[model samples]
Target: MALSTDHFSPSPDAAHLRARLSQAGLRATRQRLVILESLLTLPGHPTAEQVHRQVVRQEPSISLGTVYKALDSFVAAGLTRRVAAAEGTSRRYDADCTEHHHLFCTDTQEIIDYCDPQLDTLIREFFAAKGLQNFQPHSFSLHITGSKLANK
Candidate 1:
C-alpha cells in the first residue's frame, strides 16, 4: 500500500486555497499555505514529519514546529482532518473534508477513502430509529480495518 508520489492529483490554485483559509478565519500566511499545499499534493495520508519534509523543499527555512502548528490550524479550521493510524503508528493528515469512510490496511498501515451510499443510509436509519434523548447526529464515517490484496 505504499502509494506512488504521483498518484495524487495536483492541488487547487493559491487563490482558491487563500479563499478557503480566509473563509475558515485563518490567515493565508506563506508557511500555512506552503504546508497546506504540501499536504494536498501528497498521495495517501502523510504524517507531519513527511509533510515537513515536502515543505522543506519549497521553503527551506520552514521549521518542523511551524509545519505542526500549521497542521493544527488546518484541522481547527476544518480544512483537513487528523486521522489516527493503526496502533503504534504516527498520526496522518487528510485534506479531503468530504463525508466519507476509510479503509485501513493493517499490514501496510495505509488508509484509503471509501464511499457507500447504502451504508450511509443504513447507519442513519438505524440511529434515527434509536431516538436517543438529548443527542443529535451530525455525521458518521466507518473505518474498516483489513489488509489489501496484492495486485496481479
Candidate 2:
C-alpha cells in the first residue's frame, strides 16, 4: 500500500515501519502505521487515548479499541514497549524499544529518554561482578523520577 504522509523525512517512513512490522510478525496496516507514528512523535510517553486521538486526526474511522489492540500487539512483538504509569493514571506506550533509560518528571508527569554509555558500562561491569542468583541478565535501564529544572 502506498502511504501519502508529508511527515516522512525525519519521521519514520512507512516502508521501514512495514518491514519492522513484518519482522515482528505483524501485518503492516495503515492504521497500525499511523498509530505507531503517533507513539513515535507524541511528546513524552503517550497513553492509548493520546494515540487514538492523534490517529483519528488522520484516520477518522479508526476506533479506540483498534488503537489499544495495535499497541498491545506492538508490545508483544517487541516493536514498542509499555512504560509503567503511576497508580490511577493510564498506561503509557513508548515506541523506542532501545536499551535506554527514562527521566520521568514528577511535576508534569512527562517521560524523557536518556542514554549514557558510561552508565551502561558501569551497570554491566557491576552486574558482571555481582551476578544475580538463578537469574540471567539481558538488559537494564534506570528510570529516574524528578522535576526538570529550567535551563541555566
Candidate 3:
C-alpha cells in the first residue's frame, strides 16, 4: 500500500521515524505500517478507535486491540504523538512529527493544528527569564477552547 506523506514531509524525519522503529527491533509488519500510514494521512488528530475503524475498512482482520498495540509501539518508537482531546476523554494521534500545538472547539470537541515559531520562541524566552530550573519544557500544546457557532 502507498504511504501518504501529504501533511507530513517524506524527508529525513521519515527515515528517522522508520529507523527508530527498526532500532526498537520492530519487524515493521504490514499492520504496523498500515497504522502508521493512516496516521500520516489524516490531517486532524484521531483516536485509537477511529484509527482502528479506518484500518478495518482496508484490512478486516485488523482488530482494535492490534491497533491499540500498534499505536503504543509507534508512540514508543517516536513515530507518532498521542495528544489529549478537547474533553480529555480520548487520546488523539498526530503524525506530523513536529513541535506544534492544538486549538480545540469545546462545543464540538474538534481539534485544529496550532503552529507558530514566534510562540515557541516566546515560551522558551519566558522560561529562561524566569529561571525555571525545575521544569524543562520539551513540548507544549495549547488547547484554545471556543464554540463552533462563534467561529462560524
Candidate 4:
C-alpha cells in the first residue's frame, strides 16, 4: 500500500536513508545497505543477534560485529531506535519511528506494540508538571509483566 502524503511530505524511507547516509557523510557501502535493508524489513523489535542471523541469510560474509556497527550507525543517524527489553537478555531495535508502547509477555517472550492516546497524554502531562530538568526523553515504552501463575 502506498502511504499518503501531506504538504510537509517527509522523504520516503529509502530516500530518507540515502539522505541520512549522506548527512552522516558515510559511504553507502553494501554491508551497510544490506544490514539496513534487513532492519527495515524486519517487523517489531529484534536483538542484535537476531538481526545478524537475518542479515547473514542475505549477505553471508557479514559478521556479527559488522551488524552491531551498522545498528550503531542507524541509531546515530536517527533511522532506528534501540530498546532494551526489561529482561535484559538482549536489546531490540525498533524501525518504526512512531509514538507507541510495548506489552511484553514473560511466558512467550513476546513484545506487542501498544498505542494509547490517553496514556500518552497522561504521561506527558505528569512529566511536564514535574518540571523535569536536563531530561531528554526520546521515547517511552511500558513493559508490563504477564504470565500464568502456578498454584503451589
| Each candidate: RMSD | 3.2, 6.4, 5.8, 7.1
lDDT of each: 0.85, 0.81, 0.74, 0.73
Model 2 global lDDT (CA atoms, 0 to 1): 0.81
Better of 3 and 4 by lDDT: 3
Estimate the TM-score of every prediction: 0.90, 0.83, 0.78, 0.75
Native-vs-model 4 lDDT?
Answer: 0.73
Model 3: per-residue Cα lDDT over 22-112, one tens digit each = 8766866778767776666555788998888878877899999999999988888777888888898898888756777777778877777
Clashing pairs in 2: none
- Look at candidate 3 and tell me the lDDT of residue 6: 28
lDDT tens readout by residue for model 4, 76-109: 8777888867577888887766777766768767
Error of 4 at 63 (Å): 0.5
Weakest ten-residue segment in model 1 by summed lDDT: 1-10
Provide the global lDDT of candidate 3 against the true structure: 0.74
lDDT of 1 by residue, 63-140 (tens): 999998999989998999988885546878888888888888889787888777778899999999999799999987
**Cα lDDT tens digits for candidate 2, 3-70:** 11222235678888788889999998999888887887776678999999989999999999999999
Q: After superposition, how far is residue 59 of candidate 2 from its true place, in Å?
A: 1.9
